[model samples]
Target: MSERVGAGKSGRKKVRDGIEGAKVVELRPKQGAASDKAEQDSEDRRFIHRDNGIWRRKGDNPPTFICGPVDVLAESRDEEGRNWGLLLAWDDRDGHRHEEAFPRALFAGDGNEIRSRLADGGLTLGAGTSAKAAFLEWLASLASEQRARSVTRIGWHAFGGQSAFVLPDETIGEAGERVVLQTTEREASLFGVSGTAEDWRREIGLMCAKNSRLVFAASCAFAAPLLGLLGEEGGGISFKGDSRVGKSTALRVAASVCGGTPQNGAGGYIRSWRSTSNGIESTALASCDALLPLDEMGQLDPREAGEIAYLLSNGQGKARSSRTGGARSVARFRILFLSTGELGLADLNREAGKATKAGQEVRFADLPADAGRGMGLFEYLHHEDTPEAFARYLRTATGQIYGAPLRIFLRRLADVMANEGEDELRGRLRDRIADLADDWLKDYPAASGQVRSVAARFAMVAVGGELATSYGLTGWADDTPSYMAGECFHAWLAERGTVGRREEEQAVQQLRDFIARNGEARFERWVDAVTAAEAQSEIPDAPPGERFRTQNRAGWKRWVREDDGKSAWRYLLTSEAMSEALSGLNQRSAKAVLVERGFLLPGKDGKIAAPISPPGHKKVRAYEVMAAILGSDEGDR
Candidate 1:
């Protein structure tokens, strides 16, 4: 048995070879240590005395018991062995126990924080700087007998490693060995476990039946841990709609899968979108390899909203300079986020006066909250009569029974991975996802690669939900997860309009918007007939009919006779203007899209632009945009 020491007369023999009054914890090394190292280990564990689970130890000055009980548990180092720390265990006055890891860096400070942390954790240090310094020194001395020994490593977020699925607070799969979780500080509300598996499965889990959004959101939580397993990149799903539409409730449902469900925006498993860029990065790291539930898109700064979408979906953060002035790798993580907002990402970007890119759209797929059933965000209310009542019940149920399903699901995953190596598990998951996606895509045979990719993501969520159900954690039917996920995917696809040629569609929309906004004001009209056209340059001198002009002309417009012999308004744009209209797209490719759609009439030279002479201007070649741009033009101009 390990050596046990006591503090008072009942336990006293002598204080010889130790800090005076406290009984010497006999010099005994942990088993398996060499004689010399064993002797050293004994010294490392010196000065600790436990009295009925109370940690007490004497201070240096006056040889007094400055404080009762100082217990330092096992030491820990990061997996890379770069940072070292120790796990501290203590009991509060109420007999409640607590354990937390403190990095050595914390002790290197002025000792105030260490003492404060202990005090905050229910260990009140004795008065005086000596007591504080001496107490801290004694705690540091726990590492004094550092004989070279294999130290356990820690990770910030070790999920989906090649060998195991690990989390900062816990591991999902075989750890191969014990590893401590060393994470940055975050809010008290996040990542906390409460309630039981049965409680959650009975209440919130059962309520997910026939509820597509709830299941879809909850599945995203499960899918987070599987991203690394399936060799998938990080991304997210956004549920956007008006307030009281149950969007936040969906977020809370997803949040329940990971930990405690805080009231929306009060922040726990569900975080507010109102954070700085740095704060968002920290939040991402806090929820790494887990579902990051963000509430309220309206809260985020419009300018930063779209940028953060790219940031969260990209799986990394901004790099910073180390104190030494050298650049260090910025924090990176694998995260699956579920968000709720009054507006979708594209509209949010529009608020910032920016257009949403295709990649951004792919990274964060937006699904409308309205189910189109006249019941906001729900197809069937199950036992409830109204969506509001349903949402209220979910909020109450989730608050009671959250932070359990995650453990149950992860434990099952760990068990499976332990039996079959993680590699095999990953392969199995990939195969299942592929099979599920194939089934989901049977109707959209011509889906774009991007569409397929998004489909696979939704499919992954479905598979995770179904797997949880199969594990008996969710108590859901076998086909429920897939059906719910399908409902969401089809809704997103319909919102998107076309599965394939999304870029082409976007290009057409871009042109349409540009013309709609700029047509009359930016396009200079050409004077008809030869003499009037030649007189256009002499705007001040020419007759009113000949002096056609426009302010800041982007290009030109004219009542042109089409091949079909109908006179309609046509927009003419220079190569530069066309490029401007199709910013962020391949210039030539966008033009080809226009031609293919009969939106553009290419010249005989096979170039996008055709030669056109405007009044008083040189016959500068310009792209003749079809009158269809205006949708309908009858040469009234």
Candidate 2:
């Protein structure tokens, strides 16, 4: 099949060329670092360049040949239709045939001229996008093929660097063992071999059956050796599985070997602000360069995922500080492994897809069979049968430090936090610690000591030393709080004569009594008490009819009558009275309230009740004219 390339942006062209009779080779890079390296390699493979470098298969055989790392260049026209500088190209390798047309057309710049303008840097690749997506997929496919051992053998060359030959375990036997084990250190797996004494599968199955812990340890050791294949700038691994399959343990071993922290050692970057005399300083990922073992990979917070994704894509450090301007250049690292449990296959697919897009290598570790069938994965890790064994394991792992900066440098790190002011820095640091706890650490102690070793490698210095170390502040020594507390709890159990004892009946009664008392009282109150408010208030006040004011044509005449030798009368009336009087008028007429309030007047037909304007036609404003003006002759009376 003709492999597609450059799905998103036209960053570069995808050239298809034959390697020993039309074998399609795809080169791509993960997110973060310059993916253009992948594009350059891809172009070199497509068209046969005499001086180009690539891994070529000889005579369609299983074995592959390591070719040169060649330069690729693209020719494009400027706005005015003039040919511009060579946009992108792979330079010719030494001791290879150089095609005149390919070099002349593509690499037109003088070697000296091109070399002079450069200050020891080449063109960088942009972020992961639709255009560069095809390259990402193709690279992932190639890695997957190697990981699955689909091809008989593959030669991998580090971009801008050296090359190595990778072959299946079937072809490479262990130096000392009667049988070889077929397994990847970069992956958490156990394969079964039926026949060959040189099969890696047989060795792994034996180690797992004798002690899965050894298998876990070996997996970590293997990953460490393969770190070089991960390369600089971009690339990482993700360990995925349920609790207690030794995911963290594997990476912890890797960290111990490499001398990096478990928490910050690998995976992504952690952003923090440091206080200095001038102001606050910030550090990202904190110079962590070791195996990262991320526990509970399933439940990461959105922000952490974003931070991890960013680092994986851009190879740029990210840090945000209020005291400082904003994001300062932070250090970036790769994910060594991610550990999780009880995640849906769908969720795993989504997460893996995202990691692949960001150029990350992720492996899903299944729960160990022996542990899985016995007492569940988590229970097996903490089983009391091997207390001394686990403790000793922890001591050995904690003694080793990885990726920790020198003491002198840490003071500067402290200063960065100090400049931000102790309180602010401490608060953020606490929050960061808390996030790691909720996201990864909660299920930690339940993980195997081997996995714990990996986690300890990537953890923060304070946390790793204080919590995970046997020689540090929170070690298993008699003086340490955790150790003392565990000892005290064990003692208390012994004092109660509860060692291997069953108190099920007493516990059941206690539970029943507590629930009957507290639970019933709460339920009664909730059921009996009113739960909603009344719709209306009960307070008494004036009726709407009595509080309303009346008016007439002269002005705002009150609804009062003058006793000037005549019956008491109203100059104006309340709406209720008006309606009642109109009903008793004894005449057929339609009653109309003024659209707006107005003074009473004679009739248009000139009848006394046929309202008409007063003679002078003196009209006050509508509201004023509507007044019920009542007058009296009290003096004459």
Candidate 3:
């Protein structure tokens, strides 16, 4: 069905069937990093130990050991065998030890990236050219000295098919292996265990006993890793309301489940929503295979807020060219984030004069922050005097025991995977998630497909909490996670105001609202036959107080005899006015929804506009709207 196109040095040329007249580019093995690795291996084999010390190199003015005793731990190679790096360990002036993987790409320029990172991590380099040169020279010397074997993964699990979950400084599912994060944005220092798992369980685990919001938050964090497992693209669950409703507290609690609290109440474990799209790409990668806790959605620029929502769902950042005109690797991540704010996605986009699409709303599911128990966002106070005090208590407790539960959960998960095998465990977990989703949706049989999709994410959260509980991490009752997930889901549904498609609901509501607001004021009054005859005869209006003129007519309305022999009002709208009422939506879809709901009647030809003529007016094609849409009781669809 399609012709093959070919491009050569000259220009693009259409190719018929065979390879004739098409330039064939011979593939070459990857060079640069790959060639360097082979050269390094050869140099290692021909090593002579000519330097005074292992850390000493030939480049320094006086051959010197730049830092403390150094060890070349491993040779790290990407999965393709074309790229490599070195794992180095050394001590600093404070006698503290540091270990990191130094990628060869950093040495392509002045090597400042490598030197600055070493210094930042406490491996001191001398100040002058000799000291800097000594440091760089010593680093190059490590290519020949082998300590261990290593593999590379650009971001999260299984770098180069080395199947271990790589965290900032630790590895899961693999013993005696460490994950050293050496990306441009250094985040290793932000991830660590601060307290005992026991303390965390006692301080935070019990707090979620009767609180659905807190439970949902914790579940969201745990559910992040499962996103990759379930093969589901990432999305977020937001808790939004007016300011000071314990929203930040919910985020803090969720953040603690993944890593330590922000140091001194500053950025660390909890990241703000104020980051640019580029900055967030790096941040999202840093939190890859885990939860990204974003606080205060209001901080993002309103114009970029909806764009940010789309960005998070994209799973990768913008691809930009490097200095040499080569394509740079885009930052990629798989994460489920938690967002909190005073405004929902819809409100935020509306503030920018944009109408949110149904897909975007599903991507960032918004739930009301308030639990409606008069306890702010809390369902239970846990013996605290007030919701504020309770929230404050949880926030403080999270800071104390942050970062332990997640480590425990990962360890347990690793063991389970090792025993049950990933395939078997994934199957069971998948079935469990589907079952949970079914439970969430069984009550709302008519929910939209978008609603069902979001329900699966909520179900994933429930699985995480319940799995952690089964491993004795969360100390909650068996049914707690599922119960909390359902509670929060129903709350979200209530806020959405419809079980059907969100856009459909909006379409119906928009027309109803427009007619209710402007029917009498904007529509021209039409006359009955008797009134028309009287007007034609130049007689005073037969009806005492009837008026037939409209100031700025959008359409026409007339009183007609009903089947019950009572007069009822019916409105007919012009095509232009109908378009205005259905602005910002798919006009065709809106009209279909209106027809299905009996809000708009179709002509015998099945078109949305019917051919009708009003008294004293020529016939025209117009949209006829039922008056019942303006009734006082048009509740949930």
Candidate 4:
């Protein structure tokens, strides 16, 4: 039998045996109907659909669906014409809600993009490759709808108590016993609400009461919230000393009164001096009506040091330009910041070869970090292992028990103002501070006006501490705070010296230093000759009686006479030499000052140069400076 391929009625190829005339039937492939149904089910499972304007998972019904309630708070279109939305989403599992900025393109993209973006806002969607597409489609539809109206931006009074106080997590207001308004967006976390008022008193409050330096630092921190009401300008207090001396630790202790950590790591309260001015500006705003702690003054650039000090203390940010070249809103803050450094601002500038300005010194008042007696930044460690160990303990303890005292203080101040009236309370506090200032300045009768102002600032911090104690916030004896503050302020004043005389003393020291350094190398003096004849010939004779008879030259006679043994060794500095030696001052002015002070003698020609040596070989006009004036003692003056 010969086999031939033939088409069967079922459209299958068949083999026939020609000799036997018998045909064989073949089976054909079946249609994939079940596989198609399975794929359809998967696609349906992947795509998330919306029910009643809420997104629902594929298998979820009424009770099983996640109820996150992602609300579109506000919407805007960027320059690229892409829509952007600010969303406040709630996570039921975590019981936390966070605000996020979402772009429309993310929702319009694949499901993975949608899932990833929502996940960033703390939302987790059901997992599946096909589910992402459905979620993305649902998100896109949601984005197309009308956005919720933008709520009015609340005006926050950083320094004064108002109906509402804006915090990191919410806006706490006095609508009915301090309601938490969770709808407002917080741009910066100046203050927070954590722990309890009692916890703060136990941890940070008691610590400040025991340590005078910590008390002053914490007092400065507390003063920040009342700066506006107090009508005081913003400024910073720097604790400066050697490395590992607990300067930064003291600042951290102060920072704990608010929301900052005392640890020296990421997200800790201590800020570095190496940041740009703009970064510092933002930091100041973030610390509005609170404490701003800066660490490591040695890290700051010398050129920007003065500018940063002035900017921060001035309570304003550098004006910035917007995209359209228009002026952006200036960032402002009124705060009392604590800073740490191995060197004071003046010494730091001097090391960089820059002169320290007086204003810069006043702006950042430097207090010695070492409290003396081998205790760094502390008079006693409150019976802890060591200062370092105590500092470490504070760092840990404060991180947990912070942010409550500030709220209580504010609330108490508000209540006082409401019951007693704003002006009365302010006047009473002002009088108390003024009395403290008088006590500090009573002994410093000749204190400069600026010194009085600085003393007042220190007094304010002390008074604030006393007030906190009076309010039962700090568990300290009533009189202890003021007494310690006065003692500390007295020490600072003594270290600062007579303020108005600082410039004069510095100038005199500079002149003395120049003379001492170059006395042998640059100055000329006639030594005693081998014989009296030689000495007599080398010395110039008095010109005439008329030389001593010159008018308006009273001091000339005393220095121009023939040299006695005591005056014979006096150094003669020429006008050119004097100019070079006193380069920090005008040549003529320096000579006049010396003459007026009786250190130099005036000449018959109404000039300052006197003839101490034999008309020196070149007949140079020179002045005679008493060797006593060039001594190290003169420089100390």
Candidate 5:
């Protein structure tokens, strides 16, 4: 048995002639001064204390742990008796130190509770690469079960700042306050003991959902096989699922792994790397040490699809800084994890079941399930106890999983992208998404619209990017020349693609055919109502002393006040009708009305009307013409 040390004690002890301490512990190395100088010295290793639940010797107060790793064990109790578990373990760097264990929890209840707690807490789980993979595998098993259950409505209860409950109230026995159980243990125990088959099924289903989140987090952290596709050369994993499936939560966890936040807006994207408050941008995502989690990707406009694709396909690229005098070529910010909802891809051919057709097999892929899965784990790992612990974990872990000789999972993703065409790959994605949605809807009826909208947005992004690529321009930006290409594709798809070759020709032909059958009179009336209004009226010259005068009219009446005490000509002036008639008239007619009626006047030869300008120098005719004829001309002149 390992010797127990008190909290206050501080001294070294002998371990096979090695040194050990209550706070700063050490062990003597076994050695006979021998031949080979190649192997690293075993005795050089040291262990220090840490306070953040990580392994540490008692004496050390700094955040840094010793070069050698230490183990962690914790304890908690609840009404169902004292529950204990071996939560985590940290192995030595070289795998040579003596194994260490600590009491995780102590139960104050009956012997039964003590026994149960001991049983639960006895397992001394390690915290290295293989352990994380095993945890993910276990989570996947739960996900498979969750996928099978069709029931809907899952509630998430989050505790922030100060909260009364640590574990679920239902699971706790009829004990007084102060009794607490580790959330994991409580959840697992309740899952095991649920009574009826239906109850058990529900339990199983929820477990699967929760487990999937954990698995996703673990896989992303370790760069496991299931997550290999995320780091591929031109490959990305998208989180597409119905609302409340924890899609955003998963991406948040992924971002946490990269020390990032999933936020929107210029400051969030452009300045994420500089502060904790800001979120990561597509540009910053590329530099992340681990998978870059992008959330709410479907919110991007059709114009942004190309740049998004470039960031995903290429691990690195360039962006123009939003900051003034920003350089043209900046480092690319690619994403390892991309998430969205309501993405729809439809190929007329696919719906028709014609594989060989030119455009029949459009495919829409839903967000990846892992997004929710990862998000769940993030919640569990961080809980409410530690602020930004997940972020710190990600900062340290990204280098391990994403840098240097990249993980195997990333390599697999690269392989898949290299072999699959865009259509084929997208089709597979669509099918997966459909399945996920079908599952989600069983629990949430309202989720369908939200899911579909997000799905459509995602599809638009993809199609838009493809169109931009064809145009020989790269990326999404408000000012990029290729920005509108993707938008055009979206507009085309929305209209189901017109039968005519040209949009103008289509409109003209549509009008012509309709008019030919119905004659010009009906068409004329329809145009008259929809077109801008027009009218004509007479105006009086300004009073002798004033250079200019104006009149305001309402309906069909002109203001003829009794104050004049004289008869005046009633000018038949146009009101709303000006827009249509002037639009139909030539430039000269349009200008004449505004100037003669005092609505607008020329200031000399070319200048516009101004407070200090010469009487005729301000030319207000063009301004009137522009206002009259420019109300919504589908055609740009």
Candidate 6:
């Protein structure tokens, strides 16, 4: 046993071994069982405590540990109700940072899933027999005593203001500088950087000179960023025509203004119409406050075409259920999309034996691609080579110089809005559109309401393009866009015909077609005895009887008779034959309409039919239409 020692300044005893020369050392008091247990409890409390899936440090203001190379930007649930996290991660090998969605289960999972995901993302956990164990060990090493700062949570839908310009990896603003966020792991690699402002102007100027549609589409793309500021419901425009007629090229050109080319597939700016409504809703949300270009309208299911159009234009998604049976947040967007297809939306549905609604038709206006000048989608090929060659050149040139114009345009628009306020800018744009619409419809007074609406949409595109030019984003002659717009608008009007007169014209054409088809076969002759004698007899001085003779027919005829002491020629049609000829029209309603238009005379009992006696047949009821109502022979044709 050690010998008892004297008390030291610390009030603890100094102990000495039994050996005489052994140096004395201070000895601590032997702790009681309760004290030892208390110490043990304190030590146990120092370890991290996890509650409700969140890890918390033990000390005051303890730090939260998160691994690098990947950060969870948002949390969401998939269609099947599985927990998901939108992650912004870096890939050092490719020097590209991408946003990927991963299962939350993997992060909390027993190592294997996490390791597999990391490996799939091109990350290595070093040589280890147990990758799960290694990953866990590595995650543990990230823990530190430093306090963790709060991270800004980015919403999935980035709409309203410059925030809507957020890309997969960065947020772009009016300043033309990237607003570097915590989740921005790398610079934007897809859009690259904006070329010199003059480079964009030159390229766009060439497009403007080449095709009015191209200029219209490009301007729409540039003005898309201002849509949110415009404070109006969002809509889209479609470029529809035959395949390989430069429709796709125009869309690609428009896409180049924003970022990415037409061929970038899913990751690029262009999307396919082959997706489901939900899929498109997601795409639209991703493209909020930007240009969303969809390719191949023919790819969509005919049954869903109308609904899809309504959904996209309305900027809302279907509400869904979550795993817990609660309502999931519906996806929303405010964007102007550009669509390209070989067939127009209505024609596409018609081919599939599906009918399109009027709302769908108005939402996506169908303009004839042939510009009515023998040019297919282009009036003149501005490039030295053929249109195809120019398209190929554009594919490469556009990819090289993307994203800058949109950035600069947004910056400039923001500056203007900041200085003059949003209302002033929107009011100016509205006034411009109104003025353009008035000019476009000046000659189309009888245009249908739908036609006028479509014209307004075209005018909007025109106004948007012209505004971009006026803003100096596109280097073109100031009047070039307006001229192109007017030309396109007129061409559309010419091909579509007068809108308001469509129904009346259809009625008239139907009547003419019926008469032309059956007039000679269906009706019998109704010549008076005296007229018949005169027609059969040869006059001595007459030159083959050149004077007009009333030769009656069974189905229709024109007869000149004295009425109220005035000679008038009455256009007559047998009631039975008229009913068969104009079967599409309601006989009573058509007669009333004809009477109102002065086409027919109302007889006794307010009926349009009159009693007529043939030379050798029984009396018959015939419709006596006025000759003046039929107009000239040229008008009938």
Give each prediction's root-mean-square deviation over alpha carbons: 6.8, 29.1, 14.3, 13.9, 23.3, 13.2
How badly does each model clash, as a count of residue pairs?
Answer: 6, 75, 2, 5, 66, 4
lDDT per residue as tens, model 2, 1-637: 2234445223222222234344443332222233555544544332222333333332333323233333322222322433322222233323332211011122233232323222122322223343133222322223211111121112221211222222212212111211111111112111111222222222221222223333333233223222222332322324334455544444443333223333333122111111221111111122222233444545553224434433543334545564567754353433233233344222444464321111121122222322333532222333235534443443344333322221212233234433565456445544543454334435334533323222222222223222222222111222222222222222222322322112222222222232233322221111101111110122122112223322321222222222333211223222333333333222122122221112233344543243322224343222111212112321111
Off by over 4 Å in 1: 1-22, 26-68, 144-169, 184-189, 261-267, 530-549, 633-637
Candidate 1 vs candidate 5, lDDT winner: 1
Runs of candidate 2 exceeding 4 Å displacement:
1-218, 221-251, 260-289, 296-299, 303-310, 313-335, 338-637
Task: Kindly list the per-residue Cα lDDT of model 4 for residues 395-453, writing each as its tens digit.
Answer: 77766766677767777776776678768888988998899998878866887777777
Score each candidate by Cα lDDT.
0.72, 0.28, 0.72, 0.60, 0.29, 0.58
Consecutive 10-residue window with the lowest summed lDDT within model 3 = 23-32
Give the number of the best model, judged by TM-score: 1
Q: What is the per-residue lDDT of model 6 for residues 289-323, given as tens digits with 9 covering 90 to 100? A: 77788888889987778778899878889999999
Please, what is the TM-score per model?
Answer: 0.86, 0.23, 0.80, 0.67, 0.24, 0.61
Model 5 bad stretches (over 4 Å): 1-35, 40-277, 282-331, 335-413, 416-624, 630-637
> Which has the higher TM-score value, candidate number 2 or candidate number 6?
6
What lDDT score is found at residue 317 in candidate 3? Answer: 79
- Any idea what lDDT model 2 has? 0.28
TM-score: the better of candidates 1 and 2: 1
Stretches > 4 Å off in candidate 3: 1-69, 129-141, 144-156, 159-162, 175-179, 265-267, 324-327, 513-580, 611-621, 630-637
> Which of candidates 3 and 6 is the stronger one according to TM-score?
3
Q: Please, what are the lDDT tens digits per residue for candidate 1 over residues 39-97?
A: 44555332444463222344332343345554555566655665577666677888777
User: Order the candidates by TM-score, highest first — what do you get?
Assistant: 1, 3, 4, 6, 5, 2
